[model samples]
Target: MTALQSRIEGHILTPTGFVLGVLTLDAQGRIADISGTPVATAAVRDSGAPIVLPGFIDLHVHGGAGHDIMEGGDAALHVATLHARHGTTSLLATTMTAPQSDLDAAFAAMGPLCKQRAPNAARVLGVHLEGPYISEARLGAQPPFARPASFDEIHRLHAMAPIRLITLAPEVGGNHALIAQLVAEGFKVQLGHTTGSYEQGVAAMRCGATGFTHLFNAMSALHHREPGMVGAALAHAEFAEVIPDLLHVHPGAIHTALRAIPKLYCVTDSTSAAGMPDGDYKLGRHTVTKCMGGVRLADGTLAGSVLSMDQALRNLVDTLGLDLADASRRVSTYAADHMGLQDRGRLAAGAWGDVVVLNRDLALQAVLVEGHAVRLN
Candidate 1:
């Protein structure tokens, strides 16, 4: 294979939450070396004002940049490219609660895209099956018609595609056994969209549910008397996902949750309306309306979000008043570790040279996937 060459100069944010001097990528898309001295190459670019960090990875995103993953086909691949331009180097094409036929079609469409090797496309890490099996009560933005997944159905789908991660309600029927089966099958299980009590949530965790979906939203709220699902997630504290938009979660809550959990990763939880103007869009069978800094349904129920990972990092710093290193951990290291992605999510020798260069303003200036500059001015 012909090698590609490039050098990014700035404060390099390694996945371990440290900022180093300069990073150079060999022609073969691996970190060649890092030194204070610049490499003698024409591909050298001054990333002085921006923070060079591992490209953000989204494990749970239904749609963004005006395309829904459920829409499938090239539209799915097209939207993936859009997110790549915005600094998402890796992502899971998430699916919402929908009819069996629709879900099957989506899986069929994404299977090929996931296998195909593309330079500009954001790496489709794996499929994140949000639901077809969840509680109807806490379904959140998912369609009511597609609620709940049976054991047989789950097994069938798993057989069809290589499912990497899945989210479900622990209190739902057959969920406990399904969780155990999924763990045995080597899939990451996350609890979400339910009204499960603290005890129930704890039970799920014991059964191998290691993460939470979107932290504080789409599930039972925390209460002093009840200590619901949120309390259970906080109490366990080893693994969870937070949207960090300052809209999906408040700054105080995020800080508190981070303090409570051992590892809290940040995700966009962005919908199809993301990276687009305020308007109506489809998130599965539901119609999402975005306006004046928030997205909601006709019934005023909060839908997903319109935030990007780059902006999410900025929100953690500006809105939450967190240091750059802390914010970078939530966006990069924490998430990568939770999903078991060891090769990427860090800037080190021998790791995939997936990096994002941002300006001092936190705007995405350029992105390199596997050491090749996929997005640049």
Candidate 2:
């Protein structure tokens, strides 16, 4: 028999549920087999049988590890590495509202890396184009670059790379058609940074805007009479991305969203200041200051976040009283399903070997992507 490639013995969080078992992987980055019986061979990574969960997949992330995706190239790798260390096995390299030239440069530089993931980096599934076509009223930490949708510009960028998601305001002129076109092109058009009314939001959804970006933070709030974008998102969106940093959004609001939206997932929406000491940083063209666990603009507008996926999970489980299984789904399964990623969310046969090992206390112990162990430090 061929020598076993690698075997991990632990309490694993499989799709079915948690189970104590030995999970083996093949030479290729796929689960070769899983056995309930334990072997005497040296366990490659023994953590007193820690809880092993499917690696977290973040649908929205900006930058981390002292770098921003807008800087492109190695910056993408840096962001991915930082997130990977925090249990994110895969993520979308999210961008901010910026000039067309800057956006194009970012797309050009990071596109290839998306197609071919860098070593020791979290797999970049695609790009989340978060701005330049959103609401100026709701441009939280975004620069003054917000504008109406430009079909030609979008098409050009899409041609340059696989833009899996784009956030736009439904009220922008020609946006409904753009939403329809984006949907037709297989992009996930999301409503965000918008001041659109609930009716307009619903129309955009009908035209194929399937989700909301950073729900409740940058969009219109829910009102009893008007029902606004937030209300529309809760009432009609298939999935809504939320920042669970406990700062950008209140825990009570998160609970409301989880209760109302059928699928509510967490996103870091992090900036370069993440995983670094408190200091000044850049979020695209805007300068952001990092202090006391939050990143914000000069005017005190909350920028992205320093929150990681692991902390998000902890917030859901500890702060919101979410069960481990439910929190896992929110951080991993739901986001993967939303992106149509069939191979990385669950630890089952035929799935990519992306797993995160955690102590019973939920601290990250180890991470593996494509069956290869990553250097955490």
Candidate 3:
């Protein structure tokens, strides 16, 4: 981490929008200034200069580099480094449903990593506790240890690694009230892994649940009358996360979501197979195989994915027909807004100097986490 100030020239995507300019990073790793020069929008589309965008923020991440977060021992560091190479400046270390003892052990090893930035790695912002409070009926790729919400357990784990978000079933055992409590205490709560009806989902939102996890995957489907979790999210949600690997969610469904939710963001939901060739790898307790550019279980369940944030961005634009600006919002800005992190997402004065410099083809040329450059190759 350098204390010296730095600058980069390119087509910078600032908070107000895109402009041809120079972006300055302060010695302390916050955005110092951006000096803009007027240029035609069409000119930027074909510019040889780097296209600088806010670094990606992934709220749902399990692992990468052939290592699971549950494996402990520098695994999270390796995963963070691998993702940093792909432009993720910040991420949540997502956990799967597992026994309490195992969860405790994993947190015990990773909690400190959350508090500081490590070398050549994305900032381990916090934890996304994705399980242990879900529904057994909708375990998806999660292990089958689903249980009801418990305040004591939640507090204990939060004390370990500050949980930024949680995924659970509000219709299950006293969890609707728990959602209220978690929100009141400043935690972001999301509804998922459920057989909940539309009304239950609405009720959860009323109780302060702010988002949905991996929309339309493990959650219930929308029907003409029943209007399950998907229906609720599409009808009422302003914010939601969806994996855009083109395998977890179809391009057509993604287009529908784009028109429905205002702050629909993209996440990798990536696993240990992310940067590796096709082979078997650990995704929590389950062993998943990477084949045909996707990860799956022996039972043919779609496990996590081998997608990186850079590839996710490409899919949003090249395949899904979104413009670069809207695609940048989906991959970066909206997630930061959902997390209430003003300092991490945009290229503005006083925001963290987290950036990804891409070329005309939207390939990563450089990545920065708080002004520190990470290796791309």
- Backbone collision count in every prediction? 6, 0, 0
TM-scores for every predicted model: 0.92, 0.94, 0.98
Show model 1 residue runs off by greater than 4 Å. 1-3, 15-20, 37-49
lDDT of 1 by residue, 1-377 (tens): 12354787777766444443678887678897765533321122233444688888888888887889888776667667777887888888888898888888888788777785466767887789998767889888889854555756666766655678888998888787778877887889999988999999999999999999999998898999999999999999598999877778888999899899988988877888988898999898888999987789999888888888888888887788877767777787777898887878878887778889877677888887787667432
Instruction: Give the winner by TM-score.
Output: 3
Off by over 4 Å in 2: 1-5, 37-48
- Winner on lDDT between 1 and 2 is 2
Q: Each model's C-alpha lDDT?
A: 0.80, 0.85, 0.90
TM-score, prediction 3:
0.98
Candidate 3 structure quality by residue, lDDT tens digits, 302-328: 998988999999998899988888889
Q: Candidate 2 residues 172-253, lDDT tens each?
A: 7777778887788788889999999999999999998888999999888999999999999889877999999999888889
Better of 1 and 3 by TM-score: 3
